[model samples]
Target: MRVLTGVMLCVLLGALDQTVVIPAVPAIAADLNGFGHLSWIVTAYLLTSVSCTPIYGKLSDIYGRRALLLPAIVLFVAASGLCGMAQDLGQLIVFRALQGMGGGGLMAMAQASIADVIAPRERGRYQAYLSGMWGIASVAGPVLGGLLVDHLSWRWIFWINLPLGIAALILSNRALRNLTVHRREVRIDYPGAVLMAGCVTASLLVMSWGGSSYPWASVQILGLSAVALGLLVALVAQERRSIEPLLPPRLFGHSVFTSAVSIAFLASAAMLGATFLLPLYFQLAHGVDAATSGTLLVPFLLASVAGAYASGQAARRFGRLKYVVLTGLAVATTGFALLTLLAASAGPVAIAALMVLMGAGLGTCMPSSLVIGQNAAERRDIGTATGALLLLRAMGGAFGSALAGAVLALSFGAALTQAGHAAGIDPGLLRTGFRAGFLACTVVSAAGLLVALLMRDLPLRSGN
Candidate 1:
C-alpha cells in the first residue's frame, strides 16, 4: 500500500504536468509573447525529459530506484517552483527544461517500481489501476488548469504541483527505503550520452525549423539535417564500443523490444496529436473560453480512464493484448476520422462522442504496450527498456505537435482564405485552425492502426 501510494504520487506528478499544460498553453503564450515559440514550451520540456531517461535509467540500475527516485522528485519540485517564478518566456522555457530533467525519471521509475512489487500476471491489474489514475489525472489536469488560468492565475498551475510533489517526496522516502542496491563497477558512458543528446537535439531542431522557420530545401535546414544524421551515426558507433553503453545496442535485437518501442512511439503520436488539437476545437471552433473548452474535453479524458482500468483487468484475464491493443488503435483511428465529419458540422454532442471514442482507444493501447515491453525486457535492463519506450513516445509527441502546428499554419490559411479573411485572421492563430489540425490528426491516427496490427502476442498473464 505504501509503495503504491508513493508510486501513484510520482505518476500523478508527471501526468498532471503533461495534461494541465495543454489547456494552459494559450494563457502562457498570451502573457509571455511566446506566439512564435509556443511549440517550444512543449518541446523544451520533452527534449530534456527524454534526453535524461537513459542517464537516470542507468543510474537506477547501478545505484537503485529509491536513491535516484527521491532526488528526481526533488529536482521536479524545485523546477516547478522556478517555473511559477519565471518572468519571461526564455526563463520559463529553461525552467521547464529543468522540469523535464526530473520528468525523465518519474514515469520510468514509477513503472519500474510497480514491476518490482507485482509479479508478471498480477501486474496487469495493478497497471490498470495506475493507468486509470493516469487517465483521471489527465482529465482533471486540463479542466483544472483551464479554470485556474481563467479565474485565478496561470502561476497556480505550477503552484499546484508543489504540494503533490512534496507528498511524493515524503512517501518515496518511506516506501522506497527497501529498494537499495550496491552500485555497479561499470564506468558511465559519458561520450555516448553526449553524442546521443546532440543527435536528438539537432534532429529535433531540423524537424522543428524545416518547412516552418526556414524552407525545407534551405541551406540552414539541410545543414542541420546533415549534422543530425552524422551525429546519429557517431552515436551508434560510440554506443557499440562503450564499456557501458548509455543505450545498450543489444536490447534492440529483440523483436518484441523493437516492436514495442515502435508501437509506443506511433501510438503516442496519435494520442498526443488528438490531445494537442482537441482544445483548439473547443476554443476556436466552438468559440469557447479555456475553462469551457476543458469542460468539453471531459468526455474523452474521463472515458479514457475507464478504458485503461477496464483494459488492465481484461489483459489480466485473457492475456490477449494484441487484439485489445489493435482494437484500440482501430477505434482511435475511427474517432479521428469521425472528427473530420464532426468538425465540419456543428454539434457538441458529436464532438464529445468522438473524443470519448479516441480516449477509450488510447487507454486500451498504452498500458498493454508498456506491459508487453516490460515482459520482454531482462530484469536488470528494465530501466533501459522503459527509457527506450519513453524516449520514443516523447519524440513521437514532438513530431505530432510540430507536424500539427505546421499543418495548422498551412491549412488554417487556406480555410480563412476561402472565407475571405486570409489577411483578417492572424496566421498565428493555430488555435482556431482546429479543423485542419484535427484532419491531420485523423491521418496520423490511421497510421497507428497499421502499427497496432503488427504487435505480436505476448504470453497472457491470468492471475491479476
Candidate 2:
C-alpha cells in the first residue's frame, strides 16, 4: 500500500501538472512578455512528453522501474522550481520540457509498475484508484490553478509541485527498496530516438501552426511535412538493420498488435478531441468562466472513473477484450450521435448526459486496449510494447487535438454569417466556434467506432 500510494502520488502529479498551469497561463504570459509564444509554453511540454513516454517505458524494462521513476520525480521537482523562478517565457518553456521527461516517466512507469505488483486479475481495483486520481485532477486543476493565480501569484502554480513531489520522492525511496531490476545487455538506439523525436515534433508543428500561422498547403507546412516523412523513412530503414530497434518490427505483421494499436490510437483521438471541445463549448457557447467550464467536466471525469473500473474488471475476468472495448466505442459514438442532435440552445443537462457516455466509453476502451497490446507482446519486450502503445496513443491525441482545434477555430464567426442574426449566443464569434468544435468532435467519435470494429479478440491478462 505504501508503494501504491507513492506511485499514485507520482501519477496524480503527472496528471495535475499537465493542465494545472493552463488557467495560470494568461497571468504568466502577462509577466513573461511573449504572447506570440503562448502556444510554445504548452506545445514544448506536449511534444517532449509525446517523444519521451515510449523511451521511458523501454528504459524501465532494462533498468528498474524504481530506479528510473525516482530520478524522474527528482527531475520534475527541479524543473518545477525552474518554472517558478523563470525570468522569461523562453526559460519557463525550457523547464517545462524538462518537466515533461518526468511526466512521461511517471505515467508509463507507474502503469508498468502496477502490472508488476498486482496480478492482472486483481489489478482492476488498483487501476481504478489511478483512474480516479486523474478524475480528481481533471476536476481540480483549473479551479485550483485559477484560484492560485487570482489570490496568489502565477508562480504558485509551479510552486505547488515542490511539496507534492518531495513527498512522492521520500515515499518512493522508502517503499520501493525491494524493486527487482533486470539489467539486460541491449544497446540504446540513439538514432531511432532522434528520428522519432523529429517526426513527432514535425507533426506537432504542422498541427499547431497549420491553420493559424499558415495554410496547410503553404511552403512552411509542406517543408516541415517533408522533413518528418524523410526522418520516418530513415528511421524504418535504420531499425530494419539495427540489433535493437525502438519498436518491434514484427508488430506491423501481428494482427492483434496492429489492430489493437489502431483501436488505441482511434480511441485516444476521440477522447482527446472531446476533451478539447467540451471545454471550448462550456466557456464559449455557454458564456461560462474558464474555471466554471472546467467544473462542467465533472460528469465526464466521474463517469470515466466508473467505466474504467467496471471495464477493467470485466476484461480481467472475461478474457474477451476486443468486444469489451468495442462496446465502449459503440456507446461513446452513440453519445456523440446524440450530441449532433443537440439544438444550439440545448440545456446543460442534455450536454452533460452525452459527455458522461463519451467519457465512460473512452474509459472502458483505453485501459483494456492497453492491456491487450501489452499482453500480446513477449514478456521480454514489455518495455518496447508499452512504448509502442504510448507512442500511438500520444500521436492520436495530438492529431485529435489539432484536428478539433482547426475545425473549431477556423470557422471563427461563420455561425453569425450562416444565421444572419444570432439566435442563440450573445458572445457571437466565440460561442459559434465552440459549437462547431463540438460538432467536429462528434465526427471524430464516429470515426473511432470504425476503428473499434477492427480490434480482434485477445486474451486479457489473468496474471501478467
Candidate 3:
C-alpha cells in the first residue's frame, strides 16, 4: 500500500506538469517576451521525457528502481525550482528539458516498480490508481494553473511541484526500501543511448514543427526527417551489435510485447486525437466559452477513470485480459463513429455522453496493455518492456494530435484570410473539420481493434 501510494504520487507529479504548464504558456510567453518560441516550453519537456523513458527503464533494470527513482525525484524538484526562477525563456526551456529527464524516470520507474512488487495478474487494479491520478491531473491542472497565474504568478505552476515532489521522494524512498535490487555490473550503452535519443529528438522536432513552425514539405522538416531516419538506422545497427543493447531487439520477437505496444500506440492515437479536438468542438460548434467547454470535459475525464478502474478490477477477477481490451476498443471505435455524425447543433448532453463512451472505452485498454507487455517480457526485462510500451504510446499521442491539427487546418484554411487569422469561422465549417477529426480517430481506433484481435492473450504471471 505504501508502495502504491508512493508511485501514485510520482505519477501525479509527472502527469500534472504536462497539463499544468499549458495554461501558463501564454503567461510565461508574455512575461518572457517569447511568443515566437512559446511552443518550445512544452515541446522541450515532451521531447526529453519521451526520449529518456526507455533509458530510465533499462537503467532501473540494472541499478534497481529505487536507485533511479530517488535521483529522478531530486532532479525533478531541483529543475522545478530552476524553472520557477528562470530569467529568460531560453532558461525556462532548458530547465523544462531538465525536468523532463526526471519526469520520464518518474513514470517509467513507477510502472516498473509496480511490476517488481506485484504479480502481473493482480497488477491491473493497482494500475487503476495511477490511471486515476493521470485523469485527476488532466482535469485539475488547467484550472489550478489558471488560478495561480491569475492571482499569483505563472511561476507558481512550477513552484507548486516542490511540495508534491518532496512528498513523493520521501514516500518512495521508504516504500521501495524492500524492493529487490538485482544489480548487473555491465557497461552502460552510451553509444546506443545517444543514437536513440538523437533519433527520437529529431523525429519529435519534425512532429512539433512540421505544420506550425515550418511547412511539412519545407527543407527544415525534410532535413529533420532524413536525420531521424539515418539516426534510426544507426541505432538499429548499434543495438544489434552491442552485447547488452539499451533496447534489446529480442523483446520484439515476443508476440505479446509486439502486439501489446502496437495496440497501445493505436489506442493512444485515437484517444488523444479526440481529446485534443473535443474542447474545440464544444467551443466552436456548441458556442460555449472556454470554461464551459472545460466543464463539459469533466464527464469524459471521470468516465475514463471509472473505466480504467472497472477494467482493472475485471481483469483481476476474471483473468482474461485480451477480451477486456477488445471490448473496450470496440466500444471506443463505435463512439468515434457516432461522434462523426454529430451535427453542429448537437446538445451539450449528447456530446458529453459520447465523450463518456469513448473515454471509458479507451481507458479500459491503457493499463491492461502495460500489464500484458510486462507479463510477456522476461522478468529481467520488465523495465525495458514497460519503457518501450510507453515510448510508442507517447509517439502515438503526438502523431494523433498532429493529425487532428492538420485536419482542422483544412477547414480553417478555407474559412480564414491569407494572414492566417481566425476571423469568425463558420460553425458549419467548424463542424466539418471536427467531424473529419472524429472520423480520423475512428480509423485509428479501428486499427487498434484489429491489432487487439490479432494479439495473443498470454496468461498473466501469478508471480513477478
Query: What is the lDDT of every predicted structure here?
Result: 0.78, 0.79, 0.90
Model 2, range 39-153, lDDT digits (tens) per residue? 8888888888888887887788888788888988988899989999999998999999998877888888777777676655566667777888888887788889888999999
Which segments of model 1 are wrong by more than 4 Å? 19-40, 146-153, 180-183, 207-218, 283-286, 341-343, 414-440, 460-464
Clashes of each: 0, 0, 0
Question: Lowest summed-lDDT stretch of 10 residues in model 3?
Answer: 414-423
Strongest candidate by TM-score: 3
Where does candidate 2 stray beyond 4 Å?
413-436
- RMSD in Å for candidate 3, one decimal? 1.3
Q: Pull out the clashing pairs in model 2.
A: none
Query: How many clashes would you count in candidate 1?
Result: 0
Please give the distance, in angstroms, between residue 57's alpha carbon in candidate 3 and its true position after superposition. 0.3
| Clashing residue pairs for model 1 | none
Q: 275-326 in candidate 1: lDDT tens per residue? A: 7677766666556776677667778877777777777777777766777778
